[model samples]
Target chain A: MKTTITILLTVAIMAVGQAAVAEPVKIGMITTLSTKAGYLGEEIRDGFQLAIEQEGGTLGGIPVELLVEDDGRKPEKGIQIAERFRTRDGAKIFTGIVFSNVAMAVVPKLVREDVVYLSANAGPSKLAGDGCSPNYFSVSYQNDNLDEVVGQYVSDAGHKNVYLLAPNYPAGKDHLAGFKRYYDGEIVAEVYTKLGQADYAAEIAAIRAAEPEAVFFFLPGGMGINFLKQYAQAGLNETIPVYGPAFSFDERILGAVGAAALGVKNGSQWTHDLDNPANIQFVEAFRAKYGRTPTLYASQGYDTARLIGSGLAAVGGDLSDLEPFKAALSAADFDSVRGNFAFGANRHPIQDLYIREVVQTEDGTFTNQTLEKVFSNHVDAYAESCPQ
Target chain B: MLFFVEQSLNGLQLGITLFLMSAGLTLVFGIMRVINLAHGSFYMIGAYCGATTMAATGSFLLAIGAALIGAALAGMVVEVLVLRVLYRREHLDQVLATFGLILFCNELTRIIWGRQPLFMDVPPWLGGSIELLPGLIYPIYRLAVIGVGVAVALFLWFLFSRTRLGMQIRAGAENREMIGALGVNIRLLYTLVFGLGAMLAGLAGVMAGPIMAVESGMGEDILILTFVVIVIGGIGSIRGAVVGALLVGVVDTMGRVFLPSLFRIVFSNAYADSVAASLASMAIYLLMAAILIWRPRGLFPAHS
Candidate 1:
């Protein structure tokens, strides 16, 4: 009777230990995977998949399960989906959102739930600033970080009498302000076009009339594509050089913009052509799997997965241990696609930003080629304001 | 003076685009009394066909032909299969059915083309800017669009006024039951009218392909604008569509360009700019509201 009781106790203890160590890590990815903004989410999801595939379907030594739900680019939908993942799926680590608005919706709830929110994209400034939570970590740079670098590049290049264009929105204002903070040149004119306004003929006409030395814009997604096409159509691309952040010149958009995007300088932290072995492997594998060059969103997604994996490995997959897990995540010991990636005090990346020029490659496909380093070990502007 | 000329031209170009979209929508709603929320899907289909054919054949003319035929045929099929039944039903039912068709079309597009936006380049012959005035330059492709819109409008006018089909269409719009009782094949007329409307939408899509990103749910973006244009122009009148399109276009363009600067004279630059931007976006809606209050049936009510 004594032997039987001892054996049963031993079995119970072993089962508990196994549950702590071998329970498959479930990560819930809430993103805009459908509608017009679906492409962004698609790229991010593909990158996340690629990282898992590269790791042989395991993050660290533990098996990882990814639960993906489409937010449809709506904040309400994102919040609902994230809630489902938390309650139904028991997902503690959440990742992947394309829009900052969607991120703003769910991140607070995620923080309150004591879940680790790994932002692959949509690093809104609010989170970077005083609202920064210890539970939240952005694998991607803050929204203004790339624009800041572009601004600095424009200033350093000595482009005088520059004109700025952006959609009339809070983000647009933030982007222009970020640029103006670094650029010491004369802003000949500042134009805020309507959000989702396709035709830019009037704006183009104004640009021609002004005839600034250079033009900078912060139009992302379809807006950027439309503006660049119209800019080229208006014959402005020939005389006036264009500068923008990498969001407007990413690989997904280069195909649509085609030759028009050529010679345009944009700032980014990661490019496909980075020399690091991890990045080289990632780019080649991504191309082989997806049949196109991965955008910066994809790179960020891949990095997010690896970053989480590093943390998981350090803690031996015991995510229930919160303090040690956070510390492990902050360590960021993975080989990043962007070389020399490290976390700042705010838990956003402090990495090198490069000025990338859109160029037609030998194969005739347009891609962004790294021109020069703009900011090295660049920390986000709001990091100091972050209490965490 | 040059800026004024250029902006006016820009406004005119916008008007033409709106006309192409509104003409078909107005026709469908005016004649059929069948609310077609899916008309925008035909526009999207036209764009997809244009882009695909343009890529396959490398000929803009061939792409245009394909777009028109593709959209018209798709319209005819949908009419025969789905919209035919809705003709006898209430407007609410028609709207619900057509809205479902919009969702269906969007999903179908995504399934076929994937999520990436297709790029359609202007043919080399129409790629450059034309010297409109001494200092002002406008895109040749945009001018081509204007020309096409004008040509189509004239052709539509001729169709309605001079031709037997036009007379029949006018008669059918007036009294569908009367035309049906007078030994006319009402079903065939309805199909033809819907096909023609779809064709016009396709033409607009083909023309817009070079300018805008061709992607899924693109139809929805312009769908609301087309509705506004139709509502302002008088639901079923082609003349109303033309006038309304031009008015809305000019107002919207001018407002976007000049409002902020005009306000800056009175208010602080920052406050003025933000307010102006918001007001400019609302300018068209405000105009529509005012017009509706003055003339409840729109600026040119077709039936009256």
Candidate 2:
């Protein structure tokens, strides 16, 4: 009887020890998965999942549990998901928020709780500046970076007068401000339309009357598609060249906008046609898997996942204490798809921005082709305000 | 002067689209007494069907036909399956049930079409702009929309005033039980009326599909405007819808274009632009309130 008891105890001890060593790290992804902009989150989630799957359901040779939940594009919903992830599921790592408003709502609270929040999209100005925290890292460009590149390009091209248009919202104002920062040109008019206004006839008429040498608009998602199609239909595209950030010129939007987007110059950090080895591999694999070209959002997500994998490998997957993992993450020792990518003092990306022109491929599909390097080692305007 | 003319035309075009939407909503509410929050869902459905058909056939006219038939059929199905019982229920219950229908329809579209917004191109024949004036160039499609809207208004007027079925529908609107006792098939009439209303909404959707992103929930934005148009037009009056739509459209367009310039005369350019944008969106609501105060029942109350 005593021999039997001893054998049972040893077996139970071994089983408990094995379970502790094999426990997977939890990474909670709170993203917008519904609404007009749902595709943005879908691409990000797919890209991130692709990275994890490439690692055989692990990151940095350690098993990980990726928990993804849709926020329905609501800040309140995002906060609820974050709280549940932290308190109930014990998730220490979080990523995948597409919109800036939800990011602002969720990131500050999560970072304060000693959890790392890696942003796959939406690097709002506030988070990049005075509100910057060590626990937060943005794998994507700052919200204004893409617009700033276009502004610089437009200015360099000697366009003396430009008409600016954007939806009337916080991000809209931020984009116009970013453009003006680098654009040394005359602003004929600055117009803010109602958010979600489908019809742009009034705005188009105003643009024609003003007759600016060039037009720069910051409409994203369905708004962009509407503006581009109507702008083309109104015959404005023939006389006045148009410029914008890359948000509206992604592959999915290009398919929707078709020839309207062709030849339009937009700003982006990465394109599927990027020649780097990491980007090449990523593009091919993504297209093979999803049967669609990867957008800049997908690149950011894939980079974010790889960055986390690097941290996990450095710490040998031990997350009980976050200091070593934090140090490893700060190191940023990963091959980014965007060549020469690094973290700024505020933990936002300091990388190259390229001017990409939309083109129809030989196969008759619309996609972007990188034309010129607009900015190299570019730091965000708000990064200087960061205490770090 | 050219800018003013173009802006006015733009206003008229917007008014026409709103008219198409409000006319249908008013008819359903006037004749059937069902407050359908799901009216927008039908609009969305029509756009989806139009877009899918456009992709498959590459013919805009066929797409329009598909949209009309699809929306009318969907409306009849809803009338039979869900709305027939709601006619006897309270307004609050009707609102709740229709709201649920909107959710179901939205989800159903998402499941079928996927989350990505679908694209529909303007028909090639009507693709370009024409010079309305020496300096003013306007899209041929916008003018076509205005033409269509005017044609539809005339048709509705003739149907209500001259046709036998129209008489029954008008009489039915006056008193549901009286029409039933007078040997009309009230159930079939109600279904037909609902289907006609849905068809009008579908026409609006097809017209809008090429201009806007044909995506899920695209209906809700215009739906709010349609509601406002109906309320301002007298809930059950077609004439009210016409006048209300034009007034709202012109006021909205003119306000957006000229309000900032007016404010700039008094305030700084920056301050003027911000205030103008805020007030422009509010212009329609402000108009509704003023109208309600002046005429407690809309411009042409059909009931009284």
Docking class of 1: medium
B59 in model 1: Cα distance from truth in Å? 0.4
Determine which window of 10 residues in candidate 1 chain A has minimal summed lDDT.
A16-25
Runs of candidate 1 with Cα error greater than 4 angstroms are A1-21
Q: Candidate 2, DockQ to 2 decimals?
A: 0.76
DockQ, each predicted model:
0.72, 0.76
Residue A204 displacement in candidate 1 (angstroms): 0.7
lDDT of candidate 1 over A95-200, digit per residue (tens): 9989988898889777877789999999999999999999999999999889999999999998877998999888999888889888999988778888888788
Q: What residue pairs are clashing in model 2? A: none
Clashing pairs in 1: none
What's the lDDT for residue A249 in model 1?
A: 88
- Cα lDDT tens digits, model 1, B1-304, are 8898889989999999989989998998889998899989999999999999998989999999999999999999999999998888999999999999998998899899988888789999999998978877889999999999999999999999999999999999999999999988989999999999999999999899998888888888788888888899989999999999999889989998889789989998777877888898888999899989999999899998
